[model samples]
Structure formats: C-alpha cells, structure tokens
Target: MIRIHEVTRRFGDTTALDAVSLDIAEGEFFALLGPSGCGKTTLLRVLAGFETPDSGTVTLDGRDLLALAPHRRPVNLMFQSYALFPHMTVERNIAYGLAREGLPRAEIRERVTEVLDTVGLTALARRRPQQLSGGQRQRVALARAIVKRPRLLLLDEPLSALDKQVRAEMQLELKRLQHEAGITFLVVTHDQEEAMSLADRIAVLDAGRVQQVDTPVELYRRPRGRFVAGFVGANNIFAGRLLASGGLDVPGVGVLPAAAGDAASGDITGLVAVRPENIRFADPDGDADAPLQGTVLDISFFGGSSRIAVTVPGLDRPVLLTAPGPAPVAPGARVALSWHPESAVLIEETVETTVETTHG
Candidate 1:
C-alpha cells in the first residue's frame, strides 16, 4: 500500500500540490486524473521519490519514502515519452537493470527472454527504440519497468503519444498486465473516459488540489458540485432562483425539486445541471410539466451517436442533447424537451467551486 499524508509541494511562488492525501491499495489500478498543470505529474513524481513534498510525508508499505532516494525506493516510473534508449536493442534495454546489478550473462538472457515474451515483443528483441512502432516502444518501456519487479508502478500519460487505435489496445494490455503482475499501478491521465474505463478508483485533481475522488459512475451520477457535472460531460445548466416554496423554477427548464439543494426556497442560489442524455425531446402539446420548448440550432454527427443544439427562450446558452442515429429536428425547427426529475442534480452555485472542482 502507498500512503500520501498531507503532501504539499511548491515551486517558487506556485503551489503544485496543496495538502493532498490519498491511499493507493496493493494490486489496485489507481488513476490520477486532471488537466495540464493540475499537479498530476507533480504527484506522480512525488510518489516515485523524484520530487519531495514541502509538507507531510509519503510512505510505501510502512517505509518512509521521503527518506529514500529515487533508485532506492521500490517504485518504477514509465514516462509518457517511453524514454527508451535509442541505441540499445529492446532485449538489452529490458536487461539493463539486471546487467547493472552484476547478474550473469546467462541469467540476464533468460530473464530478458521471459520479459520480452510477456510484453509480446520476443520477435522484436533485436529492434531498437527508433525501429519499433509507438505502441511497441510503449510495450518495451513496460517490459523494462516490470523486469525489476518493483512494488509500485507509476505511469505518467503513457498513452498520449499513441494513435487512437493503438491507445485503445494498449490500455487493455496495460490493464491486463497490471492484474497479472498483482502490483499497485498508479497512472496519471487527463482523459476522463480513460480513467472511467481503467481505474478501480479515480482521483480528479485540478489547480494543485483534489476535486473529487470516487468511482466513475458515482462521480457522474452524484456530482458533489456543479463543476464535476459540467467537467465530466456535456451538461445543460439551467439558472434560476429558488422560490419561497421548496420548488425550483427555471424560466426555461421549469420548476424542479428544490429539495435537491437541501436549502429551503428563498435560501437557494444554485443552478440545476442535467446531462445531455438525460434531456429527451418531446411533443410541444405533450404535458404542462414539459415546458422546455426550444428551437433547433445545430446538429453534429459523431459516428457512434449525434448531438443537437437547441436554443430555448429565457436561456442564454444552447442546450446540448445526445440523440441516436440522426437528429430528429432540422435547424429553425421548434421542439419541446423534458427530463426525468432524478436526472438532474442541483448543487450550490459558486464560481470558486466551479473553477476549483473541474478536472479538465
């Protein structure tokens, strides 16, 4: 297990990490998710013992990591660039650590063969880093890191360099390898879908602080604040003040459950956020409860699905709706939209929390 207790880091006047604390369980694939300059990389470096925290401490399996050097720590890092030696062949690169440890040539050859086979690179053992494809180079990096049998593994944006197809394949391969090795894998990534699909748990960080850390489904369904809902995906945010009664009245979207805010009527000041998929197009003459009428403004094709932009009266921003196959309405067409009561979450509205909580 890896423990991060009140870790804080500062570079000059900027604080890269602001008193963050987390625990990464053994054999778990823990992901650090955030945008660029959100301190994900800084946290990874701290875990790898390359960067020391200004406050608090990092411990691995009861050993104080702050007291050890990078090489002395039982951790290995796989850099985003794959950082393979351009001149060395794949086999030699994987065996370099063992060679430095003064292992016999025969032992090094056996271990190298096994690791190459494990990463599906046995046939390309003689190839240099420059000679292999992007995905293959990444595999070589993985082979190098696991050959040492480290207690914890750190990956810093390891898939950003690959093409989409290769990235998808490598993501599954990495997940499988981590499970087979039964080691704690800590990955730093900014991609929400990646974190959702591959992580046992995700820590969403932003501006050197933790926004929300939980399972993907929980984060999506029950966002603690408005920033998380908008950041995770396309959201239709309806702005309106709370009524004296416990009911939410959006001029365009209509009255929702004021109880969602936990504040009584006049005390509520937040907006209601609903996901694009939750908003359904309805007939204008449907029901009085379906008062969300809008004009179709634009449509976009996304191969697997499509998105429609609708501009409604009393709202400044267009609402994005996800529709299957093709859009049902053309531009300039008037449409009615409705959503289930449970689909939208009403969180407190503060620009500070919005800016601080969103990961990407």
Candidate 2:
C-alpha cells in the first residue's frame, strides 16, 4: 500500500502538484489519470522516489519513502520509452539490475529466466533492443524492472508506444501480470479508455489537483460536477434554470419533471448533463414529456453504434446522442429525445468556490 499525504511539488514558480493526496491499496491497479500537465506523472514520480515533494511525505506500507533514495527504495519505474539497454540482450538487460546488486551468477540467471518467462519473453531473451518490436521491448522493460520483485511497480505510460492492437493486448497482459506478481502498480495515463479499462480505480487529476477518485463505473455514472461529467465522456446538456422549489425550467427541455441532486430552490441558473446513451430517440407525438423535439442535424455511423446530432430550438449548441445498432437515425430526420430525470445529473457550471454567508 502507498499513501501520499498533502504532497506538493513546484518547478520554478509554477506548481506541478498541489497538496494532492491519495491512498493506493496493495495489489490494486491504481491509475493516476489526467490530460497533459495535470500532475499525474508528477505524483507517480513522487511515489517512485524520482521526484520529491515540496511538502508532505510519500509512504509505502507505513515506511517513509521520502527518506529512501530512488535506488534504495523497493520500487521500479518502467518508462514510456521502454528504457531497455540497446547494447545488452534481453537476458542481460533484465539481469543488469540483479548484477548491480551483486547477486551470484546462478541467482541472476535464475531471476532472469524466471522474469523472462513471466513476461512471455523466454524465447527472445538473446535478442537485442533493435531486433525486437515495440511490444517485445516493452515486455523486456517490464521483465527488467520486475526482475528484482520490488514491492511497488510504477508504470509511466507503459503502453503509449504500442499501436492500438498491441496496446489492447498489452493492457490485458499487464492486468494478468499484475495478478501473477501480486505487487502494487501505479500507472500514469492520459488515455481515457486506457484508464477506464485498465485501472481498478482511477484518480482523475487536473491542473495539480485531484478532481475525483473512483472506479470507472462510479466515475462515469455518478460524476460529481461539471469537469468530471464532461471529461469522462460525451454528455448532452440542456441549459435551464431551477424554479423556486426543486423543479427544472428549461426553455426548450421544459420542467424536467423529476428534480436531480441538491439544486437549491432559488438558483434559477443551471445545466443538465445526460450521457448520450441515456437519451433515447422516441416518436415525438407518442410521448407527452417531449424534452427535445428536433431536426437531426448530423449523423455518424461507427458500425456498432451511431451518433445523432439533434438541433433543438432555444438551445444554441447541438445535442449529441448515441444509440446502439447500425440504424439509429438519418441526417435531417425529425426525432424526439426524452430522458428520465433521475438518469440525468444536474451540475454547477464549474468547481469554483462561491462565497457563502455562514451567519456572522
């Protein structure tokens, strides 16, 4: 297990990580996910002992990692580039760490052989870096890092270099390898699908802060606010206002009958976020609560699913809706869009702090 307590890091005047803290459970495939410059990698590097925090401590299994040197800590970082030694063969590259630790030749050979097999690189142990493909080199990098059997493994964009097919294969391989090794893994990735598919739980980071940390399902289904909803996936929004009570008053999507969350009675301005898949296309005349009756402006086909862009009156932006199957809707067709109030989420426009009068 690893715990980061109020960790902050700065380079020059810009803060890279700001009081970010989270606990990573042992054997959990934890992912620090965010877009570029969001400080996910900084947090990983802090955990790996490569980068120290300006404040607070990094602890692994209750031991203070801040006091330990990078090489001294029981952790290994697999770089994005697959940082394998080009001059050394796969076996030697993997054995390099063990050799530095002054292990006996027989023990090194045993570890090298064991890890190569673990990474499914046994047959290619004699090949050099240039002789192997990207995926093989990745396995070599993994084998080399895990040869020591460190208590924690840090993977920095481990599959970024691979093509789509190879990346998917490696994702499955990584998950299986984690179970086999039974060591904690902290992966930093910007790819949303990768984080959703690979992580046991994700810590969504943004601009030096953690926005939300939860399982992929929780993140998608129950996003807390504007950023989480928009960042996680495509969401259709209906700009409206809340009435004096807990009722919705949309100019176009009218009184979204069921109230959502804790939208205060007097707050007249708000937005509704509904996942594209949640919005179903229905016959306008058939349903009474026709929130959006629109002309289909654009339609895109993706074999399995299709996206229908609907243009509703009073809304400036087009609403994107996703439906399963090859036949969703055609462009320029009229459609009715409806959603259960409970299925949609009402969010404050942003995460900004509003001044509240907490009684003098």
Candidate 3:
C-alpha cells in the first residue's frame, strides 16, 4: 500500500539515500536490512515524515504521503529505545496518544484495554515501565503504536535491546503481532537473522542503494548481485570467467560447476556463489579430478551441525563446509569438495569494487 519513488536524501556531501525506491504491499511484513550507515534508517525516517528528502516522492494508497504532516500521516514510528514513559503505567502510557488526539475517554479506555489484551499485557497494565522486562517494554511500545490503528508501522531496531533468548522470542511475537494487527509493517534492522525470520520480504541495502529485494528463500538461494550474495548469508564466492558450457573458470580452483542460465553465451567474467551447506565431502574413491581438494584446517561443532574449514591449494581463504551432526573428518584430513552444477549461482559483476568476504 506504500510506494516510495526515487527518494533521495543528503546530509551535506554525504548522500544518505540515492534514488531509493520500494513497494510495500498492504498488510505485508517488510524489512529494510543493511549494515551500519547503509541508509536503511534514513529511508525509514523519510517514510515517517521525520526527515524530508531532497528529491523524490512518497505515496501511501495512491495519496501523496510527503504532503502530510508527521502527526497527520496515518503512520507511527516505534523508536529503537522503546521510548516508554518511566513514570506512567502500561495502560496510561498506551493511552497517552489517544488522549492527546482528543479521543473520547471511553474510547481511549476501550482501545487501551483491547491492545493490552492483544499484547498479552492485561495483567500488567498498571505496572510502570521500570517494573517490566525489556521484552515487556517492547510490547508496551508496540501496544502504544498500534493503539492508534495506523495504516503503517515503522520499527527501528525493535529487538536490539533484548538478550538473545528474549530477542528470539520477541521476533516470533513481532511476526504474530503484525499478522494479527493487519498493519503494513516496515522494520529497519542490521541483524540479518531478525529480518530473515520476521519479514515476509526483505530489501537489502548497501552504499545508500537497494542491492536486492526478495523473499528470504530467494535472497539466500539466488542473490542477484555481489553485495546481496555476500550480505544476506554465508556464501563462498569465486571470481572467474564464464565458460561456454555454463561453468565458472576460477584461476587456481579450476572449473567449478555452475548453471548456464547464469549468463548467456559470450559473457567473459562473473562470480560463482556456493553456500557451505550445498558443498559436500566427496568419497575418497570418487573422481580424482574433483574440482576442489583441500586439507581440513579446523572443525567447530554447533549443537545440530559442524563447520569445517578447509585450506585449498590456490585459494587465499579456506573453503567452509557445513556437515550435519558431527565432524565427518578429522583436522588435517584430505577431503574432496563437490556440489551440483545448479547449486552454484552466477553473479555478473556490474562494478569494479569488491565486497568484503565473509568467513563462516
């Protein structure tokens, strides 16, 4: 229900947003994800009317949203700090906005009561913010924002303050709350896990531009560009030239398996991206001409899986492999790595700059 068209914002010589455009469907849970200073929060502020763009337009339901005042706009921004009143009780804090808007006393009471129950804070409605935990305070902030029944809700790092355990719980809570409220939710977060778990669709931003916008699965499986591939998840990217047979020719790694659809005929150079989970340990008796053979550098075990780092002959960095359950091979063991041709995604680079490689 929201369309942001070519929005550009600048602070002095630094451009915060550069011709950024996005479409958020009605009742859709969307996320603006990027690292620090990638312009995600700036874009969110532009949508909420807190920051005016130097150029471009914003529309909500086909109406010009920029023309409306912050308070007049049918949108609410929940700050990262939660911004709850320390002195006021939960119900009173939630009802503050409605009271200021001159809503009827009875209507305010009804709305606050309903929202308190919706957020499962009915029993603690009379408790002060200091009395509540971080997660509870977040719910109160959410309750306050939704009490207005906004057409859109903008959340800025909504779960950053909570511990890892509480953060996970609140992630599920946030998704459930958004679904129940039927509001268009646009959350800004640098946490990839948060965005992937809570948002139906995510827009990955980098250098003040949108790298790609897609569902969590597509963003993980088929990243359209180098930044998206490198940022969204753990990917082993090989810089190489594309062969006529639809394979990537890495200088020292030899020809790695890739899909022909990654590039048309005559394309010279591209990137081959493979996820660790997609790579497997080839049997010792398997093809000796395997594309990659490495010495297992080290292995770290998580509860459900193991991560093995393999030092290849010609690669500057070790190739990572994820095995289920336990370490399949001991450290310093010779292992052959293989993956399906279709598992490798070809990313045709459009820029000369390089993305920082991530090690799992």
Query: What's model 2's overall lDDT?
Result: 0.81
Tens digit of lDDT per residue, candidate 2, span 168-202?
Answer: 99999999999998988889998888999998999
How well does model 1 score by local distance difference test?
A: 0.81
Question: Which stretches of model 2 miss by more than 4 angstroms?
Answer: 242-247, 257-269, 349-360
lDDT of 2 at 334: 83
Model 3 root-mean-square deviation? 2.1
Cα lDDT for residue 13, candidate 2: 91
lDDT string for model 3 (15-85, tens) is 99999999999999999999999999999999889999999999998999999999999999999999899
What TM-score would each prediction reach against the true structure?
A: 0.91, 0.91, 0.95
lDDT for predicted candidate 3 compared with the true structure: 0.88
TM-score of 2: 0.91
Q: Which 10 consecutive positions of candidate 2 have the poorest summed lDDT?
A: 351-360
- Best TM-score among the predictions, by candidate number: 3
Better of 1 and 3 by lDDT: 3
Give the higher-TM-score candidate: 1 or 3.
3
